[model samples]
Target: MKAATFFDGIGWREGVVELVDGGARLRDEVPATGIPRLDGVVVGGFTDHHVHLQLVDHSQLACSRLGRVVDLGGDPDVVQRLAVHPVRIEFAGAFLAAPGGYPSDRAWAPDGSVREIADADAAAAAVTEMAEAGASCIKVTSNSVAGPVFTDELLRTVVELAADRGLLVVAHAEGAGESERVIRLGAARLAHAPFTERLDDDQIARQSASASWISTLAIHDDPARAVAIDNVRRFHTAGGTVLYGTDLGNGPMPVDLSPREIAALREAGLDDAALLRALSPVDPLDPDSNLLLLPGSSPAAADPLAARPLTPADLKV
Candidate 1:
């Protein structure tokens, strides 16, 4: 019987986890058998909801603390091949963009990373390509600040096509009006907290009612970071769902559960409880899944989300 404190991705409870035969079972009392006690806080598996597999040294992921990663943009073939990683991999294939749109010109974007679809017909073709390639969702780029963006006609086209294929559309909504456009066109997720402009209460309310925002808050410089954090705070206040995503592989960022990203989310007013929900994209209370055992008998009370992950061997011990 392993005695440990368990945070079920929401609330904390003192419980004993017994690995009876081959699985962990949570119980309130200690069992009468010999088993190594879990010496730390066991929480739900953490997920980095936004990443780019093409830009990172993915070889390190096999030993990484992350339990899951979602590749927001990458080479479809490369993402497919990397799905065998020990850490669960979910991905959205190639950036579907307007001709001469954002990321088509970015130096870090690898070849086969962008499919510049031009019209409704082209949008359907592009969406079909991604779905056929086994993408969990569709990624659309509407970065009017960087280059040409999708017109309302094209945005509607992509959203409609993606829906027909049973896929959700996640958009890189940037610039003055891009966020509003995509929110209006029904993008299911935002790749980043809208940073370029302060959203009106109505805009935030609309987004809160209709979609979720991924907090890539630490990726920005001071003024933008400040703006993004403010928006996140207000959006969450309005009952908007906030997803903890770092937009990993964007630059000098950690591939693991990023402390800096977690710090920024905390700064944005996500307390331990809200941050716990943000960290776990998948259900943590499942009977079969082994929960994440982080090192430490007790995590920092002031910064509980900063706990470091334990290796598999460490968990067994």
Candidate 2:
């Protein structure tokens, strides 16, 4: 099918892609100006690896140019039901955290969405429950800013349980030193970029050694965005794996490809290739066909516009 590519780094590019069994398969990489003015079906499908689909207006989300979402923190039953739709739903069942941790007080968090665990045994049970309920992975929150965060011992136990269950552990680590703790525990992914504190050399080294950070820079206001950029810069310098994500439902934000988040990544020093890699659905370590396409030559080097902070308008059906 014909398609218009949203080259995340440069401008958008036009091309044709074939969707086989619901996944994109590159058909032909056509030149931008050479895009044939022919008539055919065009599919603009892209995956948002981290999202809280049930919390947001799914109807509004449909307005964005996104094909699917990987719900990082939500109800597994809702996720199971969501999966029956054409827009694929992959997820971590719920937000597993220390008792009285984040999202518990967040007004948007649903009744079953927060799975609070106090100890290692409880953590294991929580992880097992999520798995049995059809979680693609496990999400654990360690946000001291909100309330009591996970203890090192508790975090270790949760990680171990996740490992034993053959599930990837994603942590919502915030507050001083939480990044280091998760890094040391070998978290598979971070729910948000480390915004609470900058990483020390050892911490950065550990972060580089393992773990990937999802970008949710657009959620923060001016000062916070600046802090987030600095944090991301250091992580990038240390060679940490960075993935593009927008905490879609935490507040008002874009439902599709987020340009402001992309701009923040650029400000943090990601170059063309790195930006592409960050936006790419394909894993960088093991290349795959899930590459995003934007139909144009790299745009002229232009002064970066201020962070617009994405809103619903950016998303299109």
Give all candidates' CA lDDT scores. Answer: 0.81, 0.67
List model 1 lDDT by residue over 1-317, tens digit each.
56666776657766666555655656655434565667677765578899998788877766666777899999998898884354788899999988999999988999999999877888888889889989999999999888999888889888988999999999999889888889899899999999999999999999999999999998999899999999999999999999999988988877777878888898989976688778873343555343666565464442444455433454365
Could you give candidate 2's per-residue lDDT for residues 100-195 as a string of tens digits?
888888878987898888777788788888989878789988888789888788888888888888888888888887877777876888888887
Model 2: number of clashes? 15
- Model 1 regions more than 4 Å off: 10-16, 19-39, 281-290, 295-317
On TM-score, the candidate that comes out on top is 1
After superposition of all CA atoms, the RMSD between model 1 and the true structure is 3.2
TM-score of 2: 0.77
Candidate 2 weakest ten by summed lDDT: 302-311
TM-score of 1: 0.88
Give the C-alpha miss distance for residue 58 in model 1, angstroms: 1.0
Residue 116 lDDT in candidate 2: 81
